[model samples]
Target: MPLFRAEHGGAKARPRRRRTRNMEWVGSCGKTDENGHVLSLTRLCLLSLANNMKDMWAKDYADNYLDHYSFRYIMGPFTLLPGELVEELTWLLCTRKQMSRAALHLMLVPQLRGLSLESCPSLVTATLCAHIAARCRGLRSLDLSGGQQLPSKVLCETLCCLPALRSLSLAGTPCDRGVIKAIAQRCPLLRHLDISRCHLLSPAALLPLGAPLPPLPLISLLALDIGFGEQEGDPAAAAAYLLLSLPGLERVAMEGLGQACCLIQQRQFNRSDGFTDREGVPRLVELWRDWRHRQGTDTCRTMREAAAREEEEEERTLSDGFGSDSEEEARRDGGPNCSQNQTEDRKRGGDLSDDGCLVLQLKDVKGISCDFLDSLSLACPNISSISVHVDDFENTRGESQGSLLATGLQAWSAQLRSLSMYHPGPLVNLLPALQVACSSLVSLTLEGVKIGPHTPLLEVIKACPGLRDLLISAEPPTTPWEAEDEEDQRAEQNLPRLANLCSLTLNFSYEHSQMKPVMSCMSLEKVLKCLLAGSPLLEKLSLVSLPCPLNGILQEVLDLLHLHQYFFADSTNSPLMPLGRVQRVNLLRTDVTMMTVRSLMQRSKRLKYVDVSYCWRISQVEWMHCERSTEVQVVWL
Candidate 1:
């Protein structure tokens, strides 16, 4: 396992998995006994184990490992105990490995949020939660999912300590109905709460859900979820009118939302929103719930699951339309009138950023004029991370594309160490702009962006030597040569080659010129001499569109090249070189055979990532007949 260290003063730690036992013991102790006989055993025996476990704590090495951006976590016995748990917890909340950790946390946290850990099986629940609650002061979101060992009292004390808790997940938590109501009242600031498997929750347990508070009144709650039995009590009524009293909620997700669909559909609001009255309210709660139940059922498992939605849902209304909640005093606050949809958008936008880092999340702002973006740039100067999605979204017609503010980007590139942009044109256009505008653009990603003519992109890349992620579409150069004259030729010659291409993918769609083997024996002999170069730091490569060679071409070339032992009979094709520090290369639609792969393995000891999708020839061959590529990841799709 390899740990990748990023410049953000963070690193990743890899997990070492042992398969011998359900609980494999790994300690930093070495003991030798000739007869393998113990004289005596007592609490002293376990103490030795503990001592050995404690000895494995090489804090310096662990700290170094924690400094990386990505790594696989391998648990050691010493690091899994109660005290050791604290150390592991501290290593993450306080160290590097943050990029990879953020990636993993983002993936799991959504599912883990609002879960109760009274059912966690791997550790002593009460002791673990108590310890974590005491130390993890930064735990704003908790997952007490399936926490089988955490008793109600442990949860109560821990819940009180977590004043900053914004989300609580009690799915499968063993707390009784009484405990649920008490905790809800205690933690009124909670925005999201899940009581999913409280096969024990009742309306009485939820009455405290709307208990009033004093002075500022703690009315910041927003979301609540609960699972319904085939025929449970009125948990639905408790959530509906109960939330109305607080007067401040934007979104909610719950199971068995079919019944609540009736309430929202019958309620009155507005037609401009396609949500007459409260008709659209049900859509918010069931969207996530629908995704959860539809997982693996020919439906989307993710919420922003736009990729899988085949069609839009129909609309219906219950109550009359057009009015504010004058019933609540806070609703009477004076403000210039805005469209209800704009108000809803503002409410949703204000949902999470209070404690989290400042963000520039501009998505689907249809026709946002240059002046609008410029104004925004002036407002959020503290933003360090940005996610911009301008989909077919156009600026004001006739406005120069240059008018949209790049000030925010320029500011971010200077202060930010992490940048992720998702736009086909802006990403490519901004590359050179960023290089010229900011001195430090270390960690940046340009995903799914169409970079026109490879030359400009190459120019930008060369300019930004500090770039760590240059992910771009593999489209071939639209204009391979710009040399109308000698001056142009000289400039083209100065451009970088495929050698420095750290990660590459040859566009499968573009015009692909065929790679014919050397015509003569002499030329065939020279293929081995052409050493691979310029692939330093190259971990992944895809050679797309190279069709399988004809049988005669394959055999003749193999023998002509003197590849009697399949492709690498000579010393030239030995597997000892990893170009540009590359660890792996994937062959996509290539004509190369297993023999050629064998030559690759024989030549490069660092070989990894060899996968073939939709290839039938390799599927039929026996392992003995086929030469194996000693690699880390091999997938035959």
Candidate 2:
């Protein structure tokens, strides 16, 4: 009989006691506290031993530890940790200078899914890639960007092994045409590929993908970044071929395509072949044009056949006495005719070959003309993000091309959600068009643009109600008085409240020299206060090279936080308080004091990153105090 008896109470029952295992509690405590400390200490000891192994005693000790104790005892606790933690530990170990061949072999486990050895010149060798290919067969993402030492042959062979790879970034690697062909032939399941800055890769490297008879097409590829790569042949023809062939591509970064597009357009308009004898440009252009025409013809033929079949089906239905007389009369009177529908479908399908492309990156591209932009718009009707350098358009050709560039931007403004422009060559003429057409813009970046009375930064903010991320790198005005006057005028105007704004960066650093005086309409305390007050949801605030002192700005933010708390004390509806969501504050090269840093840390509860590099006022002692007070990472150098 048990004390805890059944509900019927048939008999007396004994009470059930909870079981407490001392071993489980001891194991949890050891793994949580002692194991981490012991492992870190052992890793430090091992690194020291590896460095001093030239001595007789150190060599003996290291050999003994590696042979008898390292894997059996030191690595036993890692099994209890999660796979992600293990992978991160492996990456850290591999990046260290003390990492040897034996250590690398130990880290390459079977459960590894993602590995990034980016810019690790010492670790990214052909043998390392071979070892990864052999061990990490289940890997999904691999980033070996800037691995200049990795040989192309080994890379190709390594890619052939990892068929499960979904993302692969080989930027700045010396991959050639053969490697590109191998990737297209083997890795069909790849979704994102980045081969940017691969100077050895020619334009012909992508031609194999568009070939009629291929191993297979990269049908699952969604994003391709081939930007900044120096090509041997005609890049425009290759890009056109790719767009026509791969209708599944959603984002493409062709940073140097502006010059190539202009070249193609110029050649066509002038009926000249400037590059006919060089690099087989004429042959590739002809091939692309022919393929495009064939695609349109095939689409039209297919649509007509489908329409004919539909008409036949309707006539058969009428003959079977299932249709009314009114229906017959309407069909005869050309109401919703099948031919019209077919024609419309054919026109739409023929015009847009790469309608799936949503993002295009053309940074540092020059010579963008109107016809090329129109053609691009027709091909990719849904481009939402674009990064371009406007100075190229103004400085390379003339002012007319800049106007053409502005017109192209206007054409795309209706669909653009993110726009980034560098250098202020003709932004004065471009801003008005943007104000009217860019109502749907969610992110805008203007770098090296002069923001004065002419630019009117407030007007741009007001125009885009949905803007969430804004970055302005304004060059300093010629005189300090002008900047002060502009700031005063701006502070007088009613600041627009940006409820949806999450990130804001205002950089007033002169491009050539950092010691120069800060000059901008945004280099004042009142203007910053108004901006911060308007952005209630701001998470990241970066003020680089500003003239205004950090204490005043931080004080304003602290006051706002206190005011928000007081007002919302009794209200339970608001989940986020003002300035509470500020996670990152970058004050690079600005005049920030240690007191301001401490104040910001005390007020902003969720602040995680504080960058005070090049800040002259904060002493080491004060920095140590701020660092020891909280877990927030303070970057100072």
Clashes of 2: 5
Model 1 TM-score relative to the real fold: 0.38
Residue-pair clashes per prediction, in order, are 58, 5
Best candidate, lDDT? 2
TM-score of 2: 0.71
Q: What is the TM-score of each candidate against the true structure?
A: 0.38, 0.71
Candidate 1 structure lDDT:
0.40
RMSD (Å) per prediction: 21.0, 12.0
User: Model 1, 327-407: lDDT tens per residue?
Assistant: 222233422233443344346653222212112222111112233334334333444433343332445564433324354
Judged by lDDT against the true structure, how good is candidate 2? 0.61
- List the candidate 2 regions with Cα displacement exceeding 4 Å: 1-107, 119-122, 202-206, 212-233, 255-322, 325-371, 392-402, 426-429, 451-453, 482-493, 510-527, 570-576
